[model samples]
Target: MRRDKIAVLVPEMEGKIRILLFWLVVMSAPAFSQQAPKIVSSADTASIRIGEQIRWTVAVEVDSAAQVIFPEGQTFSPLETVEAFMTDTTRKNDRLLLQKTYALTQFDSGGYILPTQRIEIDGKGFFTDSILVMVATVPVDTVNQKMYDIKPMMEVQASRWGWLKWVALGLLAVLLAGGAYYWFFLRKKPLSEEEAEALLPPYERAMKELKRLEQSRYLIQDEFKQYYTELTSIVRGYLEEEVHISALESTTGQLLEKIELLRDAGKLDLEDNTLRQFQNILETADLVKFAKSKPELRKAEEDRNKVEEIVQKTKEAIPEPTEEELLQQEEYRMAVAEQQRKRKIRFALGAAAGLLVVALVSAIGYFGFQTVKDYLIGNPSKNLLEGEWVSSSYGYPPVILETPEVLYRKEIELPPEAMGTIQDLDAFAYDDHRANLSIAAVSTVFTKTDEAPDYEGAVDQILAGFERNGARNIITKQEEFTTVSGIPGTKVFGRGNFKIPDSDEFLKGKYAILLFGGNGFMQQVVISWEEDDLYAEEIVDRILNTIEVKTVI
Candidate 1:
């Protein structure tokens, strides 16, 4: 029975293994037979006006087993992508279709060939076909209207917040500096009791110190040196406090000399014997300290006793103040203390004012006087008007001008039609686009046209080119222009709606175009900025006055 059961189990196991192998073969077969992912890229329009928008769409197809990963970001260069939409997912047959769309625009009027964009499917890279896009200019009518000079630099109001930030920063710096100074220098440590003594009459204060010294154990400890030192200190302090003597700072010999002088001057009235006795005690104490001389215990005790007699006798000899005299002394002391307090206050104020003056001067020296003035007066145009101006040659037949900042050379290629009779094209721009201001110059040598560069024809050609680049509804006023160096040219000023590159939306801006040169080539300088910026008017005026144009055939 066991053998028969084993035989049936072997066939069952073999059949199960065979079925698993068959399914594996079926799954592997599709991996080999499946074709590579198919990608299709398309655009709603092949052409757009400068600053006008266009939709670019890309479709990606992948098998159900393969994951489709789409490109994300502004892959189109020269042409800017202003908007990106989420990929739309769909299923057709057994393949998955993933579609992504982008909104793109160009600020320049020209033909651009977008390079092949890479797409990835299942870890493999695939490229889309390169496409050509022609950007046209915004249209303007120059036949019937007078052209205007470029409006002045718009007086852009300096944002108070900008000044506020610097002000706040300066105040913070001052506060930090003051705090550190107080912490390290001006702030006083609290006084201990000895330094914070109570206000007492001079005699009483000297007496209190004497009593305190007597209570000390220097005598009992046989510390004769310290004992005599305290004894002499009490006498000298009493003389300085009650008798108006400089005895505390006097030498033993100096005190003897001052004593005799005081007696002669009637400033002191002690007996001659008392003076001799006091001198002997001071001399003996000085010997112990300076010469390390040891005195007999008997002599030291005699000196201690003499110290008391001298203090008492001297106290009695000093005349007591009358009630009126006490009042006058009090008033004098109060006046002196008040004067000291006022002096301290004046010193502190003077120091603070000095710091403030230093800070002001430093700000002027580092940031310029005009910058500080503008911050104080809230003037935004002062810096540009009074700032350092740089002069340079730009483009061929270089348009020499001075600007607050240097102009950057930008390379541009003219199409065969735009070139008509022009050659050797050069361009320079000072557009930091984020600011919405653009200044550019184009100089080209004409090789195909013999017609002298007519004033009206040149203005029309410039206006047409501006229109092609997305300027529309142009209102212009034209006048004969002379540069700073006296190069004659035609200046065209106008305001128009500039189509946002790659989008249909419009932004109103002011423009100034200068056209000159007649021998063989033409020179053009174009400046454009947002129309709402009134401060730009002055900038245009200042730039034109400083410009020196040179044209060559």
Candidate 2:
């Protein structure tokens, strides 16, 4: 029994000793790393000719997972940098290599001490060794060369500014003569009787034109064509001169448009029926003159009487100008005349100033706008701007949009996460996502949130998901953007390979624009179209301008 028990205890003791040895070996073992972090600094040549460039390089070796912050804005005072290349990054397995190169030059010939550069990696700081550089002037072959003494300085006759002085005197003399002429002749002239007559009131001017047209004897000679022409001209001229419209040049349709515009602008108070009567008269006159249509004598007379009625009604509708308004108008005319006289007096100066202004504008239009546009960049789809656009609303929160054409509602299957938070989603799309010369979309969703949505994060996720579906080579740049209605959101824009619909052909020249805003409701606007489509960009802007974010509590 003792032997069996001792044998069992011995086996157990041996097993325990083996376990202890394994533990000791494991604890004492050295750890292994795939890459060791290091930094290197060197120059292509330690010595350089004065004003010549020295290729200076700094390289860092770090682990792929490590964060390395290289020195920035490092100044070499005596030796200036001509060009500093951006930091280049490369990876080899688990290690990452970062290299920065600079071209340094020194004008003064001397030895200068290069400053030590600092690098930070994973919260640990490392430094580069300071080095000395020699910048020396080029050697001359004096032993075999002949040196000459400096030549004596020759006296140059100073350029004469006498011509400039004469020009100034001439300009002054002309200005004085012009001033005297204006003072004695133009400014001193009083208004003549005919000139005063031309300044009659609006109603008075209309009456004069009507009376003159009547005296032309165009009505009785059966120059009915001439009669109606003169009558229409008198009426149009009266409207142009009195009502401040370009009625004489306007067609019958154009007259109505202009009148409507004035009515909307609160500048004119003409009734619809009055405008309809005016249109009818103009149309009848056009028929008589151009269409060779002979109207009955009574109908012609009736049309003439209708024109007279319109004139009377217009005169009655003319509100008596307030005393202050009449005075201002008179003063404005006099001031304009005075300015014209002054301009004649200072014609030379004004011409010079005007030329300078024109030159400045030309330069800005050609140069300054280009430079500012480089810095003040906006969405690239600015080419498609046009006069016609259609506005419509879509989705739960009603995403209002103004696009080149009305957007057709598109159905999309929502992801599970979105379905949970979103109660309803409505999408509107303009194109089929293929050959989208200019495609646009607007979406609004009713979500279960009273607080403002995470627009930035929401856009990120949206872009991420968008990249996965049909979209390849996706690149996105995000910025804080605001809606036209003052709703804060995110602006995501970039170029990517847009997949065409129902085909395998992928186009690389396309821009993707996305805007997102939310509160209790979420709104999204997306526009992806062919690259360099200025018309599409203009449409995108129009659609964006109509974006309105609504919160439904």
Candidate 3:
């Protein structure tokens, strides 16, 4: 019985030993294979002249198939390895092969040691031995040499073409001849005063008719339609004579359009309001004529009065002839001489007054703005707490903060509850080359104490009490860690679609918010929105990241 028990225990013991031995072998296999790889470099000592190419090869062999990583900052010396090829094998017939070839050339004569490359196989790393390479000096020959220095070849200067000079002179001669011919043959004949007076009849007749209509009493007699018709015809006839357009034949709207074009081109001196008044009178007349509508007696009288007033006003405000036209007219020479004398006096007085006013304004504005900026910077706490701080981004407008109580009172003023909710509130400052204001929050009557355990504990909570009730497509991207107003914070950029209540489609737009804070007070939070999603969040991130409290005083 004892022998039988012993035999059974022995077999069990042997089985346990074999299992342990198998595990030991498995663990040692990795350790043994992790040994450093073997590396050998050719050319222990070699000589080469300057500007001569030298070829070298490094061969490495490892125990098993393993990945090799080169050493950091290791390179071939005086020799650039142009090509490197590596080979590996796992079969009993063949082994792993790593061959590296380097082609080197040196400009300076010096001996150099080619440092060994670092090889890494199966997490084990080793360095190969360094090889020496000698660079020889260039040979000098002193025989068959001349002692005197040779003169350098001179560059020839290009000569100017005489034919081009003659051609230019010929062109000038031809131009002079043509100008002489024009002066002698094509000169305009002087016109007699009689001929000039004859040319004035059309303008004179139009002016006379306008003056007669102005003095007439048709409007006072309640004939508004006829009065306006004759009045418009008189002015139109004058325009036809003065500006060469058939204004009388055109509709009121068409005539107004033509007048506007002429005004823009600087051919007319009629004020916009005056032209608009004419259009109103014509439109009213058309309504009475085409729509068969009757006008009030008082309005008819006013229309008639306006017609005569417009004709006289337009006649008095006729534009003077342009400089080119003045040169063509005999009367303009006298007008120009008189204008030059008046212009000199006006220019001197105007320039002196303008400079004085500009200097005073510039000094006042500069000092005033500087004082205000200094005050704000000196009292950041007061400035920040006095008003509810509000900011906006591109595609948005100014968001005003009414009071501090609104923010610290724990009330959230969402879009629906707020009066005149804002969208695309973009505030830009020229100095920073970036949007100064982005991210906005409004307070409502909803308080954190309404649902939380306590106010202080509620503040400690992350993303609690605050509701994203109306925010759409909200995406948040974590930016670099930073501080605002000396408060440690992390930047998070959020962008999404937004819509405000009781507004047009312009109020529905994209918005970006930058939330920065850790535990205590948040130094600054910027918000921006745009009508279009134009990388507003990216711009917000850039602004928030660059926001360093220049002065916390």
Candidate 4:
């Protein structure tokens, strides 16, 4: 019984293994067979006249279903689209057919090639061929119309004014008379010269007396209290005359405190020590004056001398200058004149220098602009890869070109293990003009599987590297253009040779080709530094034949 059971279990286990292997093979088959959609242009005819409508059809064929996106802002005038038709029913058998019709018209006469169209099929994209359209002018009628004369338009007249104006004028005259009388009666008369002179005598006398008191040497004779008192009175008298304040009646302590209050209010400019010295002298004098205390004779004499000095110093320290001093201000006038002269000179020099710089910059800018314009118009470079070619091995995601320029840079996504070993790759295009192309891989690799990473940084890094390598001038011919692939691609080319930095062996011979792609979903191709002798003609032919434009919208 045990041997029979074992024989039956072996067959069951073998059957299960076979089923698992079959499923794996079926899943991997689709990955290998997947290809980018085929985009092609099918127009009834190539040429159409201006002001005449032309219908151009674009056909996209794919193995599976697809979404075809038309270009934005499509207009025909000189070519106008009368109608557009998009139909999916054209799909027959296993292939899918996607088509869009556009009626284009141009009012002016000229020839223009329509930009490439982008198509997406089964999540893959491709570009269709560019179509050229011709435009012609419309004829005008020769017949003229006869002219006729007509009558002129009439104008309207205005009416004159009359007499209540005089009555109103009379009332105005009476009101003016009353206003004058009231203003004259209310206004005060100005003081006469005699009265003004009488009022000034007391101020003049008080100042003279204060000066006489300041000259007295009472404080130098051991009379500290007397000296401080006299000094304070003189300062008070001067303030009273100059500022109309009754400072003379205030005590020394009271006066000093009031000055400090004024200083805090931004009304005084005296240093703290000036006020403190006044206060110290007054306080010492007060003790001598009121308490009958006699300080030492020598000290009292010094104090007395300081009192005279203080009185004179305080009078000189007042903020406002006397009228006579103002009249003698010739030095200040001379200094201001000197400053104005210097300022004018500086202004004139600065203006001249600025004008010179502006003129120089204008000349340089005009010449630079002319150089760029000439290069773009007269010496345009042709696309190195413009025709048809086939790939021996199809990569996972097909390489796409975004622009027509020569230098191509693209970022390719890959598994961590595969990304680690692939540092960079190169592509080349061989042409008679020494046109070359090259792209480098500078993407980062990650091992973690939890979340997907942004590949934009990796793409940007690769583009930056291309620019730093001076790829812009490698193809010197102006015909070189920038182009994008159905995926993401950047192409730039011109003319001239690019010396690979720090290399003893220069790629000086002829055309260069650089194409890179990965099994992982992203890839790039660039061609640069072509050899002049070896395979130059063949390389150029191969590149032009295989290149295709894929448009997204």
Best by TM-score: 1
Task: For residues 203-312, write the lDDT of model 3, one tens digit per residue.
Answer: 57656666676677875776666766776676677777777676878987788888888878877778878987888888888887677667886786677677666766
Clashes of each: 40, 5, 22, 85
lDDT of 2: 0.68
| Regions of candidate 3 where Cα sits further than 4 Å from its true position | 25-38, 43-45, 55-125, 140-228, 231-553
| C-alpha lDDT (0 to 100) for residue 553 of candidate 1 | 40
TM-scores for every predicted model: 0.36, 0.32, 0.28, 0.23
lDDT of 3 at 364: 61
Q: TM-score winner between 1 and 3, please give it.
A: 1
* Model 1 steric clash total: 40
| Clashes (candidate 2) | 5
- Computed on alpha carbons, the lDDT of every model, listed in order, comes to 0.74, 0.68, 0.51, 0.50
| Top candidate, metric lDDT | 1
Candidate 4, lDDT over the whole model:
0.50
Worst 10 residues of 1 by lDDT: 140-149
- What lDDT is obtained when candidate 3 is compared to the true structure? 0.51
lDDT of 4 by residue, 1-553 (tens): 9999999999999999999999999999989776566666777766654335567787776675545566534443334444576554466576677777776654446787766666655455567777777665432222222322222333423222223445675687567545544444434557896666445644464455555655667645655666656655655666666544557777776777777776676555667777776677667767877887777766655654565555555555556766876766567767887886677557656665785578557756877754444323522223223322223211222232222333333444556765554443223222233344332222222333222322233334443555575433232111122233222233323234445555534454222222222222223343443545323345444544454322110
**lDDT, residue 127, candidate 1:** 92
